[model samples]
Target: AAARNQEKRMVADVKRKEQAVAERILENDEYAQVQEEIERQHRAYEKKFQDSLGRHASEERNRQILITKTTDKVDLIDTTGRGVRPFEPSQVTTIRDHSFGLGHNPRKSGKLLDDVIDMVRDKPE
Candidate 1:
């Protein structure tokens, strides 16, 4: 009877130790899983942030291109207007010279003056 009781006690102790080991293993697994989840979330957030930054950069680049194109068009218009300016002064001089001609006819001079005025009126500001 004494030997049987000793064996039973030893078995109970072993079972308690095994239970403790199993609980420790479970806790370690839970901790590892939690860490993995945290890492995944961090990676996802970083990717999202990078994507947003890239999109903003792209938008800024497009906006800059639009501004440059608009500026170029304005400069081209200004240059075109400058090219047309010399003809205006020459037309005025022609009108003056024609008015002071040696044998000017009133009807012909009036028609010429009218044509010059029309040309000047058709020009943009």
Candidate 2:
């Protein structure tokens, strides 16, 4: 009877130790993930701050930062300067000929679904 009791206590002790280790590992992983997310947010905020300062250069990119996108043409405006400093309007550029208003690269889009539909339609009645 004493030997059986000793064996039971040993098993319980092992299980308790394993549970503790698992809990510790899970807690550390959660902490690491939270830290990584915080860093990502910080980086994004930093980029926004830099872009705001640069996009408005000396004369504020000549205040011509109005990006236009219509059915026929799509225009994109950007400052040709980098870093965390304001630049002159000469450093700003525009891309009025972008995309040419044509959507997609015209490459077998949804080919799988079309083929499946074709197979069903070709079945003999």
lDDT by residue for model 1 (1-125), tens: 99999999999999999999999999999999999999999999999878868977778767665444331222122334467453332232223344444555343346555554564577589
Least lDDT summed over 10 consecutive residues: which range in candidate 1? 70-79
Clashes within 3 Å, all models in order: 0, 0
Give the number of colliding residue pairs in candidate 1.
Answer: 0
TM-score each candidate.
0.43, 0.43
lDDT, candidates in the order shown: 0.61, 0.55
Residue 9, candidate 1: C-alpha displacement in angstroms: 1.2
RMSD to true structure for each model, in Å = 18.7, 17.4
Q: Candidate 1 has which clashing residue pairs, if any?
A: none
Question: Once model 1 is optimally superposed onto the true structure by TM-score, how far is the C-alpha of residue 4 displaced, in angstroms?
Answer: 1.6
Looking at model 2, report the run of 10 residues with the lowest lDDT sum: 65-74
What is the overall TM-score of model 1 with all chains considered together? 0.43
